[model samples]
Target: MIAKSNEARCTSCHAGYGWKGNDFDFTDQTGVDCLVCHEQTGTYKKFPAGAGNPAPREMVFPGNGKTYHPPDWNKVAQSVGRPTRNNCGTCHFFGGGGDGVKHGDLDSSLMKPNKMLDVHMGTDGQNFDCVRCHSTTLHNIAGRVYTTPAYEHRKSLIEDDLASKITCESCHSSSPHKEDAKANDHTDKVACQSCHVPRFARVNPTKMWWDWSQAGKKKNGKPYKVKGELERPEYDTLKGDMKWAKDVVPEYYWYNGSIEHLTVKDVIDPGKDVVINRPVGDKDDIHSRIFPFKVHRGKQPYDKVNKTLVVPHLFPKGPADADAYWKTFDWGKAIAFGMDYTGLPYSGEYDFVETSYVFPITHMVAPKDNVVACKECHAHEGGRLAKLTGFYMPGRDNFRALDTLGWIVVIGALLGVVLHGLGRVFTANGRKEQ
Candidate 1:
């Protein structure tokens, strides 16, 4: 299943490159095709089932007595040029099965976004591409995932000089707010994206919840699907129950540029929702800063005897393969096949366990004017930063002694001014009468 998933699903994005086996051979010269991204003519095509190889010229359409011919490869290769937004977005925009399914901030709407949606990538503005921030050197991309940030300069100083640098501070210094001192002061405690990206999935909705436990449910012995809000599939026989949301307000948390990922071998507590991937940080850590995140929750299969999460082989190798879960809807056979591939023991007993993963919100940056207002985070009630601890905010937090001292000074100054005004008026009247 792992081999099929990687070769079939994963290879769809890099269809121009060639792969001989399940494992990607980095040493193989034919595996990396430069024209996939650089091809501007859009003539290059890949065979979806051929493990990243080009489609055959005389491919026959299944069940249709029709023939399809791909473009000339030599001519397509000659027209190769620099990559564009469409070339890079081909895979990223449609990640996690569909558009806006995985990352809330990235989607097909960014292809020609307006300035209001994203200042940097907007066609009316800077019109920057993914490479602007995620610069590459010899095919090594600079930026890192939110789970494992490599460019957080304030946290965990990287000792490797060869490592790529792509933090917001790399272009805009740590003190970016030159005009507003108050805004600059918050930079130490808050991330630039926390305020800049007010909300995500503005143009489209993103999947927030998935329930594999509800899978294999059939209505009248046939696989069925139900649509929910926005006409999205709420349930499917192939996948499972899902919940999607749009214009989502991100959950805030502190991050120190590190994360802990739960592997297949790790034991989990069935009593609680397992954190598949968690960012490492704390409020007291000086290197940590408040960043926005999208928390994706789901329920997946777990082994009762092994006390670990199980990896089920869902795809079938052939039409008659009984071990495939999608084909047979038999959890026992699927789990056994997966466990055997991993060389791990699996108990027949299995149950769905709650799990969650966090993805940091770093894209969909709105213009400067669209940033969060000061009152949004500092309000006395229902403030965005109210849940955050280890710091004192003047309007949000109150100290009895400090409040009393401030009131006394204000009252004393007012009383002195009133008395001086009265005395001056009385002396002026007396001088006029004399």
Candidate 2:
């Protein structure tokens, strides 16, 4: 037992990374002693790093240890403090491009112990914890050799399955750019960020940190910041309540064209008179927009059934006026579905598939720069926009267009008097000539 005290536990007990282990034998105490890991010169030489920390109980951890007693478990747990990315970053983060740590994040600042609160909202907003989006469950976030899908939602099935990427999809709405496409020709994703964001840029839910040293120096050193501006999206005010993060990137949009509905058109020929070159088929992909999906606090792998975040009236700003809105009308839209309508005569090579059936490409428009009210889209009167046609004269916005019409009518009446006088002069001259 005395000799065991000198030697520490083997790799197995250390849990490889000092987290927890399956066969943890504190008694085995292999490899190195507690003093070594604790940074002590000898037995009983350890003290807490911070000033004024009370001297720890003069005992060693029990169970596997050969000597000494463990600290009061409850006292330690209470003082454990909030978890932070720093704990993970100590080993995971590397900016200078060395030691297999390349998430391509342009940040070099080291993580701080209690800084989580500053990065994300506290346990009162929709997003309570910062770790909800940054880290993973079951520990040590897993990633492939060539990491892809910079964020979880945009990640493909090729990287992580639908489940692992669920968090990404939830926050970033997955619906069509438009809500009810059949009613209002909403095109690409309206959340906007989904479209306009540079391929892999993401916001830091933890802390907004960047590496001044490596930021400007490109891989080839030709002024890396010279890269074109990262197109950030802009979000509209929520029912005149609040605005979203100013840095969000929206989609690239432009009017493709117009169509009443998205469906397939039928083509007909009688008695095989027309040599059928193309086959007719089906378009089955159909999507819909059900706004305000349920969102709870936390990050990746969001549990849909039961969970919620702490949303305050305001803190970073002030307590929220009311509880968090929780759901979002943004990012809700429909998609096209496809199907096979034609029964082909042959099996494989000669099998016919429909080319005409598609989500009428004519209706798919891109997001444009200039924003106009939905009413402005149609110029028809008695429509939503036309009904807005009221007095629209700009006089400190004091006068309406209809107001100007009233003034014009009054001036016309006065002009009639002068015209009558001129007519009398002409009539008198005509009588003299007679």
- Report the lDDT tens digits of candidate 1 across residue range 278-394: 878888888888998888899989998778988788766557879978788988888888777667778888998999888888888999989888888878888777778777887
Q: How much lDDT does candidate 2 score?
A: 0.25
Single out the weakest 10-residue window by summed lDDT for candidate 1: 154-163
Query: Where is model 2 poorest over a 10-residue stretch in terms of lDDT?
Result: 330-339
TM-scores, in order shown?
0.81, 0.22
lDDT by residue (tens digit), candidate 2, 1-434: 01111112222122232312234344542422232223211222212210112124554422123334334544443443334443334223332112111222211222321122122222222332335444455543432111132232334345454444323343444443356643233322222222222211123211111211121122353321221122211111211111112121211221111112211222322222222111111122122111110111111111112121111111011133122111121111000000111111111111111111111111001123322334432434432223222323122223456678877887877788768777878787478778
lDDT of 2 at 129: 32
Candidate 2: regions farther than 4 A off: 1-78, 89-93, 97-102, 106-130, 134-137, 140-162, 165-167, 176-434
* Model 1 lDDT, residue 213, Cα: 84
Question: All models: lDDT?
Answer: 0.77, 0.25
